[model samples]
Every structure is written in C-alpha cells, then in structure tokens.
Target: MLYDLNIAWSPSTSAAELERTLRFSAALGYNVVALNHTITPPVPPQVANPLPKFPPSPAGPASSSSTTPDQTPNKQPKLPTVLHRATLVLNDPSAYHRLPQLGSSYDVVAVRPTTEREFQGACLNLNLTDASLISLDLAQRFPFHFRPKPCMAAVNRGLRFEVCYAQGLSSSVPGDAANDARARAAFIGNVVELVRATRGRGIVISSGARGALALRAPADVVNLLALWGLGSEKGMEGLGVLPRGVVVNEGIKRSGFRGVVDIVGTAEREKGEREDKAVGKGKAAAGEAAKEKQEKGVDNNDKNGNGENKRKIGEEEDGGGGGPEGDDNKPMSKRQAKKMKAAIRKAQNAEAKTT
Candidate 1:
C-alpha cells in the first residue's frame, strides 16, 4: 500500500519518545526501523533552520534548546554513535537473558549489541539455540530476513537481512565511488544470485542508519541501485515494491545461484548498451539544449515572456526582408529579436550611450 518510505532520526530524541515513535511507525505501516541513538532535541519554532551545523562552537553553548546529552554543563557531549555488531548469547550470557525483552519491543530486532568484535570483517552469522531453533523450525513461519551491510554478502536458503549502507553511495565513502565499481557490481550480482538460490524465503534490506541524515531517500536508493547495473525490476521485487511482478515471476524460471548470476551478467550487458545509447543521445540533446538556453536567459525569461518584443519586432518589420520599422535597426534573424531587445534594454540600463 505504501510505495514511498523514509527513516527519520532526531539526534537529541529521548528514548521514551523514540519508543513511542517506533510504536507509531509500526502502526503506520513502517515495516523497518533503521536504528540509531536517541537524540532529544529542543523545541524550535517553525521556519527556522532545523539541521545541525559544523564547527561545534567556540563558546560551546549554541542553542537555547535543551538536549539530553547537552544537559551536563561541565562535559561536552560526544556525538552519539551506534554500531551494528554481533552479540552472541553464549559469548555474552547477560545479553541472552535479556534478548526476548529487547527483541519483542522493537520492530526490527537484531541479535547484536554495542560491541566491537567481528564488526568489520564478515557477514553477521545469526545463530539461534535449540529454543530459538524451535521457533525457526516451526511448521508455519513468517519469513524473517537477516540482511547485513553491503560488506557481508547474502546467504542462500534462509531469512536474509541485507545490510546495506544508507549514506555512502552519495559521498566519498566506501559504498560510493571509492568502492571498486566492478567488484561492487559483482557483489550486487551475487546478492541477487543468493535470493534466487534461496528461493522465496527472505530478502530484507536493512539500513544501518547512525545519524539523522544517514538515511537515504527512496529515489536516491533507486539511483544508487541502478548504478550497480543491478536489475531495477528484481531489486524492486526483492524490496517487495514490484509493481508488475516482473522480476518475481521472472525469478521462478531460473534455478539456483548460477542461473541468477547468469541473468545478472546478462542484465549488466544490456544495461551497458542502454547507457551507451543514452549517453550518445544525451550529448546531442545537451548540445541542442545549451544552444537554446544560451539564446534564452537563465531564468523564466524565454518561455513566458510577454512576446511584446516579438510582437513589436513583427509590427516594425516591413515583411519584405527589411528590419523593424525603426531608424537604426540591425538586420537580425527572428531568434535574435529577443537578444536584440535584451541588449537594447541592457544599453538603456547602462545609460552610458543615449539613443
């Protein structure tokens, strides 16, 4: 029902308020929760710039607004940082004891905690005990996908969570231009391949949203996805946003990872050809567009002009290859009429030379 979606995080939001927001979000058809640290911000009047700014402040005291972290006058609050790390029950007995409580309350439950071990290297392996396994092996099960970040590739035959970076595709971070485009391309292909290999079990994209602006817009998400040369149709299907079910139906014909990989390679080839054609056409179109814009002004001067100049030029013209019916009119093409008017207007504006 909801094709458009976004994740919001206020850096100064209170924990209680966050819980309320999450509950409200769940009620409002938001299936995913891009978790971040609670940031309790001060109330501001409408029309004011609401975003945080750079250079933390020489005076240190910036806003009249109350911040939960900023309450302590003596200490400067470090920016709240959240990490997506593995938290093993056996390894950490205390966390295991509290798992059910934490898991039930949040919409997007994770098996990790605020730890640093195994955080950077591999895909997070979610292992449940005999009790948790029982839930996993239940006769009827809601497909639970375990998507890790883009660093960790998706696995076959399970509820998979694909943890993709929310911000890097826009800037000079790892997921954007810095990432080797070819290997990243392969990773995208591999991710799709894993989906087909696992059949229709699970495929969820999870955002590791750390800050307020860390989350990506859906349009941007679509564009970054298109950059990988991944199938927009399949990606849409994977995100469960497929309009016509093209990729969903198409996946059925293919069997296993190899088939999906082959399809991806083919898709990439086709995408390259389309891009080449688009580039060629875009250059030609851009040249024509630039010419038109140069002949016209930068703003809404050309399209919606009163056409009084055109009318005046038309009126003064003899219609027999002579210029406008003025004492000193230059020979001009019809296109130059507007330019001539603007020039005269400019000279008249300068007041250096009188008519």
Candidate 2:
C-alpha cells in the first residue's frame, strides 16, 4: 500500500493514534502513511500539527450515538499501511518489536536508528540490515553525512533505494527565472548523481507534508518526478509500492479507495489556498505599515530642517551679516566632507543589497 511518510510532521498524528488518518489515506490511494517521531505524541482528541487534521477513524466498536466513525484510537484502515519506526518507534522499546511485525500483515517496513553508528544494530534488530532503501531529508539546511555507495553495497546488491525529498519547513517555489533554475538545478544534480552512481538504488517523492496545509497529492508527486526525468513507474518501484509493497486488504476496490484519498487532499489544498490568502493579506498590511513609517520619518526630518533654517535666519537678524569665503586650495570642512561621503555610501549599499 502507498503511504505518506510525513504523518508525524503534519497537523495532528501519533503512531498509535493515527488510525483515522490512515483510514482516510487508505480510503484514498495510499496503502500506508509514514510517521515521524520528531513530532511529539499528539494531545488528546486535539493535537499539534501544521495543518488542521480530522481525528482518526474509529478502531473500537461502533456506537449508535457516536457522531462520527472516527472517534476511536486505532481503527485499522481498509488496507494495510506501514508505521515507520523512525524517531518515534526507536525511542519506545514497545515499538521496536511491534513495528516489524507489521511486515506479516503489510509490505514495506522501515528501520530508523538513534545514531549513524547504531545503523547496523538497529537494522539487524528490525531485520532490515540487508533491506532495500534509505529515506533522506531534502530540506536539510546543514550538511549531513551523505554517502550512499557503502550503504548500497552493504545493505544489499541490486537493491533499489527511494529518495524522499519532502518540503518540510519551506514552501517556496523560487520566485525568478534565474533563482528558480538555480534552486532546481542543485536538487536535480544531487539526485541524478545518486541515481547514476548507486545504479539499482533510486528515489521516490513524498509530501513529507504535515500541519495545516502541508500536503501535496501523490499524483502531484508523480508529476514532479517526471520533471526530474523519472516517471511514475520508476518512482513507484523506488517507493516499493508496485513490486515490493503489499496491500493489507484483499477485497477492497482500488478505484474507490484512491478516489477518497484524492478528495481529502483536495480539501486540505482548499484550506491551504485560503490560509495563503490570509498570509498574503498580512504581508500586505505589514508592507503598508513600513511605507507609512518611512514617510513619517521623512516628514519629521523635514520639520527638523525647517527649524534649523529658521534658527539660522534668526541668528543672521541678531548679528550683522558677516561672511568669509575660503579658497578651493584649503582643506574642505570635515563636516561637509563626511556628509557627502555618508550619502555616497548609503546609495552604494542600497544598490548592492538589491542585487
């Protein structure tokens, strides 16, 4: 089953409490949902997430008086979904053994560790030491230990890896032609090298979306993959969805399931669009405020200059008009020279910053 991995990063989700979201995701096209441990365990019926999320579907027995079927703690989705034991599962000993057992019920298990040094140990425990892939962070601002050759050779020969470059904190598509090209180029260059160097190992695109409006549709990811020179077929293969991953429910209708997932994402997108408008409005207000402040400062300076001019006129009235002219050969007054130099420096700095 296909699953979104940024579940933990999204608006509200817990490894044990995300049953409803899983149900909805399964109801959509995904066979599984990725969970991150970095996000704290969500609070009660309400939780912390970037996006606003509905509760997980009911796992317990249905009650006639219940308002919705999503009131329970861990209702199983119609299909099998994977629970990634990344940061969360690794911390709790309870999850260490329990997560791997899902392999019996579903396909595509994940293995995460406490440290890079613990990789082998964790992999061995999860029975994935020689398993196929590794998920890497894309929005990482700092450098990471990024060698895949050793992992490729050691993990398994002819193993295919999925590169999950998700949009975590940043939601910007570059603004200009040059900037956009520069940004996309770096991303493509890195992945292309990995795909080429690693040979059998490749990449898969995931939303890594969470919070209020972080998700992008799987189909959108498919389109994004094509832009990177890989098609959906290759991406799915890399994601272990086609050949390696298994479906949890056998009799479910594939078409209907995928349809529901699309709808949920569409809803999330609609909300995001509205939220984006609100953010844009806030920015506009802030810009207007800044402009007003600048104008007021300029006006105040003008008033000060007027006062200075009036004081000079009063001095001339009090004392007889007496003047001494200096020749150009004399050194310029320090005050006059410094003022001119300051103006030039201000202009130069402004120009430099714009570029």
**Which lDDT values do the candidates have, in the order given?**
0.36, 0.46
Give each model a TM-score.
0.29, 0.39
How far in Å is the alpha carbon of 16 misplaced in model 2?
A: 15
Model 1 spans > 4 angstroms off = 2-94, 112-158, 167-201, 210-212, 241-355
Model 2 lDDT per residue over 1-355, tens place:
4546445443345533454445555555765455543422221233222322233323322211123324443344462334432332233444444542333322233443434444434433433322233444433322323355555553353233344544422434534565445445556665655565554334544555443244455676666666656766776664445323322211111223531232223334588898999999999999999999999999999999999888655554443233233344444544445656798899999999999
Number of colliding residue pairs in each model: 18, 23
RMSD of each: 27.9, 28.1
Q: In model 1, where is the ten-residue run with the lowest total lDDT?
A: 130-139
lDDT for each residue of candidate 1 in 47-141, tens digit (9 for 90 to 100): 13232322222322221221233332434333221111111223233334443333222212233222223221113343321011101111111
